[model samples]
Target: MAVAGVSANRLELLTIADAVAREKNIDKEIVVEAIEEAIQKGAKSRYGAHHDIRAKIDIKSGEMALTRHVTVVADDWQPEDELEEFNDSAMVRLTDASKRDPEAFVGKEYIENLPPFEFGRVQTQMARQVVTGKVRDAERANQYEEFKDRVGEIVNGTVKRVEYGNTVVDLGRGEGIMRRNDSIPREVFNIGDRIRTYIYDVRAEAKGPQVMLSRSHPGFMAKLFAQEVPEVYDGVIEIRAAARDAGSRAKMAVLSNDSSIDPVGACVGMRGSRVQAVVAELQGEKIDIIQWNADEPTFIVNALAPAEVSKVVLDEEADRVEVVVPDEQLSLAIGRRGQNVRLASQLTGWQIDIITESQDSERRQREFSERTALFQEALDVDEVIAQLLVTEGFATVEDLAFVEPYEISDIEGFDEDTAEELQARARDFLDRQAAILDAKRVELGVQDEVMAVPGVTGAIAVALGEGGIKTVEDLADLATDEIRGGYEVKNGERTKVPGVLEAFNLAQEEAEMLILQARVAAGWIDASELPQPPEPEYEEELAEGEYDADAVFAAAPEGDEGEVVDDEVPAGDPDQPENA
Candidate 1:
């Protein structure tokens, strides 16, 4: 107690801690931990006698508190080692009650509070080292939690240092690393540059929080849009699809709930104020804001902006698109080494094949020539023979393209020599017709209008000339069931299930195609307008015991027996109920 008041030793320790906390702008709790560690180390060194001494500091008033070592014991003081005698180093004293009863224990208590001991040169150095380590660890852990939630959120940070292809940014709260891959290719970060980046990933480590930032992620584009466009923020404009090549260029499709507001106009703002803001943040990366379309072809056309599209042919079943552009625009549509088409494909989720108008026309010409050559060969024989061949079904140029000489000979009135002659002539005709077809095909050039009947290839035309159901629009107008009936007698007589018509045997896929073609010809019809065949009335067979009413009436006894009467109402007679 004599050493407790105004002790020079304790006053100096308190003063040092209080001043350090204020000067460093650190918490008072940190200074208390420092002081307690210092005093404990000093006590252990000077009084090498006490093993369990604790100390505390009052940071506000610069006051010190101290306690001595003590250990608890059981009431029964029987010694585990009976052979050892008691010594000062580890001693126990019995109470008066223990002496009388022979079962009492020596109760442990703090006998005295030691004075604050002054540390020697070596002891003082060790204490400072321990305190510094603890304070730094606490600071790092606190910083880690604060920054972890900020992941995926955009933040402004200064470029502090760059090393090993990683950019270190000072986020004010902590430091973040932007790996080289996450940095946009077009962006060049430099020291002291104030930049905006998205926190993509965060992790805790033994040292501190590891924050990963990114500028190239697709989400970064969405976030940038959210910040730039108020319509997007309020949920009025929804981003339907977005794609980016990061620093170079990107395309985004947006849709609006209110049809009166154009999605593209809403995002662009007046004089492109909003989108320009986003572009500036992205270091002038070009962005195309397109109106989202539900129709795949329309959407694809929009995606390839700046390159005007002449046509878009969507093969939905094949999940592909054939985009046609003018000769001048072909290179633009495909972009530099197909980059534009590739990005458009990624954006629309469709495989894209780009073709120039002239190239497409040329390709069609070649196909048409090949088809026409095949048709002319079939037509080179006697008129009767050619007419019979057409009747048996070789109508189209494609039909006869692959026909063998033997198959032609098998037709009525054609001998092997004639078959050979026609086959050779057909090949020659194909050579000549190919050129004509090419000219026709080129003249057509990706037309929306369906062609007229392919030169007498219809049921009536074929009965009068050759192939039936060659075109879908023709098939739509024909009576399918009646055609099916007539076709079965001709070709499907051998099978258990008679084929009604040649078209009836078309594969499921071909049937669907025919339906699509029909739809295009007259536009799809409503179910109500299409005639529905009536259900057949089932005839009920008479049972064995059932007889005619006339027989029963004739067999009935005179007038008393109930008679089935036939009442015929003559022209002017009053009408009577049938049941009566």
Candidate 2:
């Protein structure tokens, strides 16, 4: 009866391991191995801690085997640690083993079978902990493997719990976390409440894989649109861009491959059903469905929907645009708390500045007067001729000085002689300015070598001298940020650091070029080793659509719609103030 009871207990051990393996979704072999380790520990506690004991469980037969092992070592063998030196029952000197066996080798191992013993209270607790920990590690690994590849896909989950403004989601197979900011504003989820979110990122953390979820990510709206719109799912229409203020508002740019279908119409659905479905999901977010245009300016116009844009001035170098709207539409164009323009800017990937038509007109008049005055003073010409030149697109003295004579002569009321006289006077004015700037540079003690850098003009040299950069070496030692003026973080607070030529408003590339040229001139670097400048990006005219302000001006009849026209002010101009 005692032998039968021992057999039953062996089978029961295997049963418990199989049950745990199934419940934890781990390999049965792993469970058995953990049980083996637990048994080894308990045996050590019972058979003296010095013995090298081990345990193994049979896979097919429900039997557990125990063994005590002693390894034969060479005379020169030493213990790995002080603890091992004191616990040397597992090792037998080869010379001593040879006396007992007459053929002992350095690596020979002798094993002894051991009887199973009853588990003490401490032993049972240790065995339970070992099994639980191994199962948990396996579960975490399983969860990570199952969900890591699912990132960027929308998922449905139940709210497991909420802790400190973060919601933990039980994704049937794993768990995901949606932080407070990731959730739509003012939206809340209760325990067991079903919620849908986008898996933006998956990270393997020390405790487990962190599955990050978000309802506010731009991708979330796009994915929701895909689910509701068949064309999007079938790839007939593509969501080009998306921006969201979460629950408040969003703008989505969509394009259709087929010209027959309107991408915006398809996304909006019949009577706004499809969009309404998405809006319901996003807590009534007002969506602007913009029809994507190859022309970035036109796309921006579409992005700022429900608000009329009279004109758009694009500065491609800065990736910025200034939009002129009717005076009455300013509040609507800017939206509630500037949300509309902000979303439009995000959708078009451009920095957008909105202004009333009156404001734009006033600024244009100011620029026109400024340019006319500059031309009048520099060319020593009458106001009428300067006004005519300004009207014909001449904004600077350099424009008149270097222009082909015929171009100016073609202007209304201007002849070849008049153009020549203007050019000569403009050249004289520029020469005088250069002389003055050079005198200032000399007074400031700037070295002549500083002017030798390819891009360094007299004005730049004067500015550099004022900024305490007197030599090419000083300029060479400076970083681009020092010359371009960038933000610095001091004690976690961002502060603007003024550049030596900050007033010049140089482009980042331009500043880098100046630094590289200075370095080459100072013999700090070879001219040939300098990196080539990037090719300028030119905007393509919109596909059978003109999105440029120049196009708008040319198409519209003057004094008909009172449309604001672009003044053709280039960005980074020293005389022009930023629209921002």
* Highest lDDT against the true fold, candidate: 2
- Would you estimate the TM-scores of all the predictions? 0.48, 0.78
**What tens digits encode model 2's per-residue C-alpha lDDT throughout 242-266?**
9999988898888899999878878
Cα error, residue 394 of model 2, in Å, equals 2.2
lDDT of 1 by residue, 1-580 (tens): 1112224455565566566656544665876686577667767666664356667667656667666654434444556697843333333455533454476455554335776555566776766676777666656776677787777688999999999778999988678899989888857778999988998888888777788898887668778888888889888999888777777777787889888877787787777788888887777777777777765666777787667777666665456778777799988888887778887887898888988889888986675554445443445444455556565666564455457767877887778887677666666666666555544443434122333322222223233112333344555565433343333343646433322244434444444444444554655564455445577443354589886676566555323311111212111112211100
Provide the overall lDDT of each model, using Cα atoms, as 2-decimal numbers. Answer: 0.64, 0.83
Off by over 4 Å in 1: 1-26, 41-50, 73-112, 239-241, 257-259, 291-338, 341-580
Root-mean-square deviation of each candidate, in angstroms?
26.6, 8.4
- Model 2 CA lDDT for position 461: 95
